[model samples]
Target: MILITGTAGFIGFHLSQRLLRDGEEVVGLDVINDYYDINVKYSRLAEAGIDKNEIEYGKLVQSTTQPGYRFIKLDLTDRESLNQLFEAEKFATVVNLAAQAGVRYSLINPQAYIDSNIIGFTNILEACRHHVVKHLAYASSSSVYGLNEKMPLSTGDNVDHPISLYAASKKSNELMAHTYSHLFGLATTGLRFFTVYGPWGRPDMALFLFTEAILKGEPIKVFNHGNMVRDFTYVDDIVEGIKRVIENPPKGNPEWTGESPDPSTSKAPYKVYNIGNNDPVTLMDFILAIEEELGQKAEKNMMDLQPGDVPATYADVQDLMDDLGYKPETHIRHGIRNFLDWYREYYGYVTDQGADAGAITDQKKQ
Candidate 1:
């Protein structure tokens, strides 16, 4: 069985469903912390057939809907419990996605980031080491490329100047994974995810926040005076890439040399890849897509760029395509439309005309 951490989270929930559909037995794990809205997290779990009322800390509950899936309420920092679960389950593959996940919030509570991202990740590594997992994949982030002005950021880029504590924590994860790979010969891969958005996305994300404010007729904050760009990848595409990576574990690069080392690969069984759309959409265009989907204009609250924010991010996904034969292709408009549809249905939202907003036809849908 595969062990997926942070299963109550956005990407993890979608990934769990996909894996279950593909006939993979999955054991989902999450602490169900109240970072954003616990309601959303619970709803995600409910969709996965894990009733919120049935969950108990440190207990495993089988899924009611998907027969191949089970869930456990656990935190990564609790090493003893995590180790016990790993020892009992003997998961062949592990994916670490549970982390205190906000760039801005990291500044407010740096300790939270260290606890979940650092201490927690250490516990995961130790558990995997003792459990003899074949492959381990963990979520890295585009924010790690702090202060990097290079367009189409590649995995080989030097990411030493991380600006936020959150980014620094992710960078630290890559390093820690490499150490385990080199020492214990644990196969590990780090995925640097770009701006991911789609149905059931985090409410703190740009798409969700923009949709919420516009639907409520409130002014939406446009940071950097709307001069920003993101390689906003769809959640489905991100999960697809992850699934591919999980199936194909990396081998040590024989070509790797110590004198001139490649940052993306190592002589050890470790690697990193940037998973993104490879298409940078300007912030204004992204907002326009949301507005078009909602058929409503947003009252823009022009604001200076907040701290721990990047002006632009474009991913060079050539390595991903060359190695995994996959790339994120979802357009912003299509993604926004999908998210808006989910938001409206989940929240019982209606247009000013007392009708549901019409769905936009996605000609690019494949």
Candidate 2:
């Protein structure tokens, strides 16, 4: 069976449903904490066909309908429950998507990062070490390349200096994984995800926020004077790439040398790859796409760059393309429209008051 953390999350929920549909047994886990609107998360669980009443914190719920899919309300930091689940499941593959996710939120609550991203991930590594899983694949962010102005960020680039606590925690996850791979010969792959957006996306993300603002006829805050760029990848493409990687597990690099080591791969069966659309879209274009989807014009309030926010992000996915023969092809315009449709239906929103400049400006101050 495959065990996936954060199965109630955007990526995790999609991945879990896909795997189950393919006749694979999947054990899914999530804390179901009130980070955003718990209703959206609940809707995701419902879409996955998991019964709400059956879910228990840190306890697995077997699928009555799908037969192959199961779920549990669980936190990564719960050591005792984590260990018990790992021992019982005997998962052949483990996907670690559970973590304290937002970059800005990390600044406000650094302890959350330390608990979920660092200490919590350490427990996953320890569990994998004892369980003998064939592969341990986890989510890493492009934010790890913080403060670097390098065009088209590559996996080979040095990520020693990270600007946000979120970025630093992700870098720490890599280090911790490498150590386990070296000692226990575990095959660990860290996927560095770019700006991912689509249907059922997180409410805190740019696309969701922009859609909400535009539909309400509110002028959205354009950060950094709208001078930012992101490789906005579609959720379907991301999941396709993930499934391919999971099928073809990485082997240790025998040619790896200590004197001149390659950062992307190691002799200890550890590797990192950037999974992205590889097409950087300007922030203005992104906003325009959202406006088109909502069939409304958005008022723009240009502003300076926010702390821990990068100006641009472009992923070099040549390695991913070569390894899995995967290429992300979904355009932002199409993806934005799809998301807006889901938003209108799911949120029951039918308004066109754009947020006053004063309200959003106050949000920025906080």
Candidate 3:
């Protein structure tokens, strides 16, 4: 069986659904915290046949829709309970995706990042160590490449200079995973994801926020005075890359040497790869894609780059393509359209005579 943490999250939800569709027995875990809108999280769970009303903390509930899937409402910081779940389930593979996400929020509440990303990740590592999991794949972020001006950020690039606490926490996860891989011989892979956006994406994300603000006739915040670039990856493509990584556990590289150590791989059974579109889109162009999809212009609120924000992020996914023989193929406009459609449907918005109109009823606004 496979254990997937953060199953209520965007990428995690999509991945769990995909794995279940592929006939894999899966156990999902999430704390269901009110990080954003709890309603959205519950809706995602409901879509997976795990009713929100049926969820009780620390209890496992079977999916009503997908026979092969089950879910548990558990926090990673609760090591005893996490260990107990691991012991009982005997999960062969584990994917750790639960973390305190958001760069800007990290600046305001650094403790949340430390609590969830650092301490919680340690608990996960401990559970995996004792449970004897075959392979462990976890989420890492491209934000770890902070202050890196290099174009097309590669896994081998030095990421020791993270600006945000959130990025530092993720970098800490990579280090912790490497320690486990080196000492316990636990096979672990770290995926450095770029800007992932699609259906059921986090409301705090740029795409969702932009869509919500645009549909509400509010000005969308365009940071860095619209001079930003990102390797906007689609959620489906991200999940596909993760699925391949989960199946192919890394073997320790014999060619690896301590003299000229590669940051992406180690002599231990540990590896890191950049999973992105390898195609950078400018901020203006990204907004233009949304405008084209919605057939309405966004009221721009151009501003300077906020603290803990990067001006640009471009990924070099050559290692992923070379090793896994896969690359993200979703176009930006297509991805935006998919997200916009889901947004409108979920929030009860509609196009009225060539213009979006309706009460979105966003819980986040409450």
Strongest candidate by TM-score: 3
User: Which of the predicted structures, 1 or 3, would earn the higher TM-score when compared with the native?
Assistant: 3
Instruction: Give, for candidate 2, the lowest lDDT window spanning 10 residues.
Output: 357-366
For all predicted structures, in order, the TM-scores are 0.96, 0.94, 0.97
Query: Per-residue alpha-carbon lDDT of model 3 for 201-224, expressed as tens digits?
Result: 998999999888887789999999
Determine the C-alpha RMSD for candidate 3 after optimal superposition of all C-alphas. 2.3
Taken over the whole model, the C-alpha lDDT of each candidate is: 0.92, 0.86, 0.92
- Please report how far candidate 1 places residue 224 from its true position, in Å: 0.6
Across 336-355, the per-residue lDDT of candidate 2 in tens digits comes to 87888777666555462345
lDDT of 3 at 358: 32
* Model 1: number of backbone collisions: 0
- Report how far residue 213 has shifted in candidate 1, in Å: 0.4
Best by lDDT: 3
Off by over 4 Å in 3: 352-366
